[model samples]
Target: MKITVLGTGEGGRLHAAKLSELGHEVVVGTRDPATTLARTEPDMMGNPPMSEWLAAHPGIALLSFGAAAAAADRLVISGIDGASAVNALSGIKEQLTGKVLVDYGIPFNYGVSGPHPWPTPWGSMPTFAVLDSDSLGEQIQRALPNTHVVKAFCTQEQATVVSPGDFNGGDHTMPISGNDPEAKAAVVDLLKSYGWTDILDLGPLVSARGQEMYSHLHSAIGFALGGDRRFGLKVVR
Candidate 1:
């Protein structure tokens, strides 16, 4: 399988590396491939840059948005923010036509503080920029109607994205929302191959509101439990 991961952030780079490690042909799409590939220093958050990660995943190629999008068999819109994903994809909308897009963007502005954790004095709660009426998934679908968009991996931390079996309880469930049945199944199967055994199919792209809206709870839980890594969600039905 050939996968093209878009965005230049940690999430995009990490997913590209992991998928390439699994023996897929992976190419990363960046705003400026040359500049991104020339970095030697760590990122602003102190994680190693994409240039460094590329060292370990030498099989992967780095290309500009148009080139990468044109070459990929599948697409992963690993946008750091929902708005950026929508904006960036707008330029190459035609390239995404007929491809399955696995969107991992949360539709909230990170500049504003998230919802206050429980038991704290309630005040302004975090609000969604694309909530109540639509979601990031729905927006992408509307923007690229020719593409099959599936929403997955947006509600979890990077550490839990690939290896959900690390949870002691066994299969931790992953919910995917998309209008296309085959596209959603492709996402579920790809995730299953990555060790996520239990997956919940939340019907239609609109259902993504429930999954993406989990960001508030996710942040509150992360703050309440400590840092945001090494945790997984299980639907205990």
Candidate 2:
């Protein structure tokens, strides 16, 4: 599949590299194409010389602010903060029409310091305020009604989301919710390509509220477990 990965931070670049390694044609969309080019070269694995890395991966496309949204079969926006994803996609809503968007975002307020606060109902977990009334995924769907949006990969930490390691007990499940069945299947196939064999369908886009909140629990677990981001939860029979 021809994929355009938007954003140049660790999450975005990691996905781009993984997709490229999986034999998919990947075009990286960054505000500065030169920056992406410089970071993806062969000799630059450890301490990549900024100049050489840029010179090596010429296939990486440098997109203007709005160009990334206008191009590609699928757009995976990562690395950037949640608000940036909203702003970026909002600007290119028209271009994203009728496309399948794989949304992997969480509403986390980094500005809120000192003690993690739980903001949901007694049994509920806190999520980004945007998700309180309407989730980001739903908002994106609303903004681009023609676009098929599937919310997955939001519950797991970046490491677990990318490489979920082995199935120790029962199959580790990533909850996926979408209004479009075909879009959900497409995302499932994408996850399978990344070695995920077990997926739990949480039903409809509205279930994304639950899924996003579930991620908050995962975050809390991570915090309590001493900042280890590699662990994941499981449901066994």
Candidate 3:
């Protein structure tokens, strides 16, 4: 699969590296291509360079922030910060038409102050705000009428998101909510590619409200559990 990861932060870099390692054609889109090239060249051990990486990984292409969204295929997973979420999608809504968009966005407005607050409808939870009044997933779906949106992996800590093995207990389960069956299936497969075997499908997109709220609860748990972001929720029958 040709995957274009938009963003240059840790989340973006992590996704790019992981997908690349998984044998997918991965392109990591950054805000500034030149800066990314310069920084990645030395770090990439002189492996042709970012431009070469793009050429070698033809199917998998890295694009700039705007280009990644405008040229994604099959799936587009967003991990950009809250402030840029709406603006970021503005230019690429057409490209996302009829495709599955996996939203991993948090609504917290960071520029304000302590414990960034989530956007409207997503009220305050114990620690973080309830990210979805109707739900961020639903909002994105509504905003991009042609796209199929699903909410998943928002509650898991960044550490656990990258490496689940760090957790000592049983296998961690990642919950997903989507209105489209086929789109959900595709996301499930994507998760599996990252070694996620236990996936809990929580009904349709409406369930995103609960899923986003869970992130706040998870945040509280992280604080209480001694700053270990490697924990996850498990359902036992």
lDDT of each: 0.78, 0.67, 0.70
Cα lDDT of model 1 overall?
0.78
- Model 2, range 43-142, lDDT digits (tens) per residue? 3225354345334554555565357766676655444456566677777778677777877777655445335555432333433656556787787678
User: Least accurate stretch of 10 residues (summed lDDT) in model 3?
Assistant: 120-129
lDDT of prediction 2:
0.67
- In model 3, residue pairs whose N, Cα or C atoms come closer than 3 Å (at least 3 residues apart or on different chains), thus clashing, are 25-60, 27-61, 27-62, 28-62, 29-63, 121-133
Q: Count the clashes in each prediction.
A: 0, 4, 6
Query: Compared with the true structure, what per-residue lDDT tens digits does model 1 show for residues 55-125?
Result: 77788888898788888876555554686777788778888889888888887664454555234334344
TM-scores of the models, in the order given = 0.89, 0.78, 0.77
Ranking by TM-score: 1, 2, 3
Return the candidate ranking by lDDT, descending: 1, 3, 2
**Model 1 stretches astray by more than 4 angstroms:** 75-77, 113-126
